[model samples]
Target: MKILIAEDDLASRKYLDKILSQYGECDLTVNGMEAVEAFLMAWDVGDPYDLICLDIMMPKVDGMRALQAIRDLEKQKGVAEADQTKIIMITALHDTEYVRNSFQKGCEAYAAKPVNTEKLIEVMRQLGLQV
Candidate 1:
């Protein structure tokens, strides 16, 4: 499975890559805009990520906007929205409203900053993807 990771933090991106590498192929993007661009580009070439891990606070195009854009594409292109192609939102903020909004917007799961590896593993298991 190909996993796409969108995070502005270099260290965090690398950490995610390292953790997921043992599982399958990994793609990296610095910010949400880049993430969407990369996803679309890959899809256009007959490749799509099996999962996307996104950071809410990013330099260009935040996670919310990026998610909206991707949803639009999924609709426009008539692609199925499946839990198999999961989306995990990551943020440091403990804002209940934002978390609620994200879940409503169809994010599979949300993780607080300084992620708990075990919890992340559980989330992946729930998504039917394991590392």
Candidate 2:
């Protein structure tokens, strides 16, 4: 599986990388804009990511905006909803509003910060991604 991990905090980024690396190839991005750019480039090259783990807060675009952009791009490219890439929002924020917005914006799952590896893997499995 191809995965994209977008995170700003170095510790969280490395931690997620360690956990996710066992599952597939991971491309890391430190900001939302870069994440979007990578996503677009991958799609253009017919190498679209199967999963994207985005931090809700980041420099530049921010995860919510990035998620929306990714979904829009998929729609523009005629990717059916069932076939669109899976997105998992990762953040320290546990506010009900953030959770609701994440879902509304097309996040497949949400992982609270200090990510739980087991829970994340379970979510990946739920999404039909080989974990």
Candidate 3:
């Protein structure tokens, strides 16, 4: 699986990369803009990501907007809903509003900050990804 991790915090970025790398190749981005750009570039090259780990708050663009843009692009490109890349919204906020917005924006899962490896893996499995 090819994974894109969009996180602004250095430690969290590294931590997630370390944890997720065991499952697949990971491309890291510092903010939402870079994330979107990377996604577009990958798509153009016919190497779209299998999963995206998006942070909720980032500079240039927020995760919610980034998620919307990606979903819209997929729709515009005529990619089927079942074929769209899986996105997991990762954030420090535990607010129900963020959780609701994430699912509404098309995220497959939501992971709170200080992510648990076991639970994350479980969610990945639930999403039908080989862990």
Candidate 4:
């Protein structure tokens, strides 16, 4: 399975990519808009990733907006039963509202900043991914 990571911090992005690499192929992006672009590029090339991990705050575009766009595209095509991409928000924001919004926006999970590698592993397990 392929995974897409959207993070602004270079070190964090690299870390996530490294960890996820143990499981499968990984793609890294610096921001949400870049994540969107990468997703589109992959899809256009007939290869959609199995997972997308997004950071809440990012330049150009934010995670919430990017997720909405992806969801909208699915709705637009009227593929009501199409498999939806698994989205996980890996962000620093801990506000309850942001957490609430994440679920409302269809994220599979949300992790607070200073991410725990073990927690990530657990979450990936729930998603049927092993590391």
> Residue-wise lDDT of candidate 1 within 55-121, one digit each (tens)?
9999979987777777677677778776335789998889999899888777899999888888988
- Give candidate 1 regions above 4 Å deviation: none
How much does candidate 4 score in TM-score? Answer: 0.91
Clash tally for model 4: 0
lDDT per model vs. reference: 0.84, 0.95, 0.96, 0.84
TM-scores for candidates 1 onward, in order: 0.93, 0.98, 0.98, 0.91
Q: Over the full model, what C-alpha lDDT does candidate 4 score relative to the true structure?
A: 0.84
Q: Itemize residue pairs with steric clashes in candidate 4.
A: none
Candidate 1 lDDT: 0.84
- Candidate 4 ranges beyond 4 A from true positions: 78-82
For each predicted model, how many residue pairs clash, with residues at least 3 apart or on different chains? 0, 0, 0, 0
Q: Candidate 2 lDDT (Cα, whole model)?
A: 0.95
Over 1-131, each residue of candidate 2 has an lDDT whose tens digit, in order, gives 99999999999999989999999999999999999999999998989999999999999999999999999999898999999999999999979999999999899999998888888999999999998
23, model 1: CA deviation in Å?
Answer: 1.1
TM-score of candidate 1 versus the correct structure, residues matched by position: 0.93
lDDT of 4 at 131: 53
Candidate 2 lands at a TM-score of 0.98
